[model samples]
Target: MAFKEGFVWGTATASYQIEGAVHEGGRGESVWDEFCRMKGKITDGDNGDFACDSYHRYSEDVQLMKQIGIKAYRFSISWSRILPNGTGEINMEGVNYYNNLINELIENGIEPYVTLFHWDYPMELQYKGGWLNSESPYWFENYAAICSRLFSDRVKYWVTSNESQCYIGFGYGTGWHAPGLELPINQVVRAWHHNLKGLGLAAKAIRQNAKGEVKVGLVSCGEVGIPASDSEADLQAARNVLFDRERSEDSIDFGFGDLFEPAIKGEYPKSLIPYLPKGWQEDMKDICVPLDYIGINVYIGSIVEACEDKKYRNLKLPVGIGKTSMEWSFKPETLYWVTRFISERYNLPVYITENGMANNDWVSTDGKINDTQREDYMNQYLSALSKSIDDGADVRGYFYWSLLDNFEWAYGYAKRFGLVYVDYSNYSRKLKQSALRYKRIIETNGEILI
Candidate 1:
């Protein structure tokens, strides 16, 4: 299949993951920067103090993109790095860093897709309860305003946030990430309310300031959970794969379900409020703002069975598929069904913002990285993706999960997800076998005959 006239082929990365220099150029610390210092938080006592030195190595990375023949690159801006206090003073040096990156991409004939927030919030904001504060909308709007004024001319596409459900729920509610606080069900709803509100306000700000075709949407991780067996327990578990909890008389699912339907349907998933916080109904209107395109981040899939739970009489979710480095399953079909479901239900264009796997890689003695596993993974996933588009899924773009190896959040440098490998010890980058294969696909316009 030849690439469509307007189809996009790109790679993506986040600032915190790639660009180290946490303290350079007046860059204020983020919640993750603080979180990593906590005892027993990150694996193996690792942190991202100097992950890739991409902060100072932006030009080199841009050259790598040029060599890779990537049409566009999606990368995130570090909030704390741009605005030291998370609001007031603009760090000219930090601003110059990202500005140079955008200019470099343009010089190399590559478009820059900017993601505003990518799970790395400023420590100042976290101190004030961050997304928990209703004022977060204004704070985010302020930040958006600054970013637009700075680079809107160069940044053609804008993704407001990475994944609110994961960032907010996992970071604040589940105690898995920075500013980690294990709050109860009620507080989780509050965080969601604030996050959705922040997105709407931030989108409005971006639209007002952007000079390009502004596309705004949050990234969402998707999975089509299937049951391993035909047992009634397994079947029922597959029906409701999300994490549901009954805090009050209201029963709600936290992990995934109905939460995203509102973003596309312009309404909450039918009476999903009693499970939310007080005045949560008022937020429905705010979260229903129209978006140009929605991005789905698909890594792997799941299948589960209803195991005995002390609380819910009947509850089970997709579990145990031999796991990835991130403990995710290897179900590429889930990505296909998920894309189909959203495009059919909402009739909106879908862009796969992030889709790749992390592996413990080793370079063979012949100086070749035998990523046959990744090749198989890519072939199946892209085949399903192409089929979804062929079935009229309104899919527009597909970006690999990352451009270069970088910090893996709490996992530190343990997991590598890049088609191009980065030598963290020396900041030397190499195009892995996967990168070469991807380049060939792009070269032939994705029309390779199998």
Candidate 2:
């Protein structure tokens, strides 16, 4: 079955991953910039100091998207770029850069879905205690107000933040990403509390400040367990893992509860209540503020089943399943289960915000990227998404994880998850085979997947 009419077809990109003019446009340092400088941290010791150079080449990127028949483009704004100090005076140059990119997408008939923040927290704010401080929510709301007022006239879809799980958990818990801080549980919960509150305040600020009617949402993803079999007990097991705890304690530290529980149930997971910082419950009102939809960035899935002990247990993946270059298991059916579960549980329209596989992709000697694996991956996952749509899932849209090969956080530029191959040496973009295939899918509104 083809996707319903008006289903948005787009590509997703983050500011720090794609935009490379980090020092230009009056941009200040971000936590990522500082973190990347630490020795023995990032793989290949590489940083996003000069990523795909999308900061200067977004016009060309938008042209590529238009040529690919995408109806929309989702990109992020770097908070530090807009407010170099993370608060106070605005950076007009940074504003102008986004204005240019947004205008280009609009001119090309590509709807713009803007994410207010995608982990590029301003360094000044990190020094001011980052998300652990009580004032972080207000600071974020202020930033949201600025963005809503400036870009709302042209952009109609606003995502308050993208993947709080990664920024909070990896950045603070595992010290794997930016602002690397391995804090105790209470401090981590403190940061988590501020982020959820920030999301609500940002949504409220955008609704009140944006120039046009807008849809505001938050993006979240952690460990999502899909039932190994569709039995009542197995389905219940999946639901338990989705809300209770992830596969392990380390995985649980990734904010599976902080991101999903509060947004859906207006409270932290019961298991995590013991670690709650003081006054955490009081912030539930703002954290549970109304959102037009929920965006989920799904790639991998864990399998779960009900045991004889009347408890759910996470089942290990069977050996020898297909895996991506990043070693992520290729489980397309994950889309079907995730969308259905989120829609049924949260009663909110679901958007597949980020879904793509990292491949060992390269422009071959003939200057062609014959990434058949990626092409098949897109086909299978999107087919599953179509199945979800048919099964009463209020699934709204699907956006490929990336438009261009970019700096993949701590993995640096080693992992490539893009439809367009970026020659890191010179910042050239070549559309891969999957990109052409995706163009056809978009042109036919996903009939190609059928």
The lDDT leader among the candidates is 2
Model 1 lDDT per residue over 303-402, tens place: 5556676212332444554456676767776666667666766677788899988877777898877776776677767877877777778888889988
- RMSD per candidate (Å) reads 3.8, 1.5
What C-alpha lDDT do the candidate models reach, one value each? 0.77, 0.87
Tell me the spans in candidate 2 whose CA falls farther than 4 Å from its real position: 246-251, 255-257, 308-311
TM-score against truth, every candidate: 0.89, 0.97
Identify the leading candidate in terms of TM-score. 2
- What tens-digit string does per-residue lDDT give for candidate 2 at 194-293? 9889999898999999788999988888767799887998998887766666433444355344576786678777767776778787888888888888
lDDT of 1: 0.77
Candidate 1 lDDT trough over 10 residues, lowest sum: 243-252
Can you tell me which runs of candidate 1 are displaced by over 4 Å? 226-259, 270-272, 303-323
Superposed by TM-score, candidate 1 places the C-alpha of residue 300 at a distance from the truth, in angstroms, of: 3.0
Residue pairs clashing, model 2? none
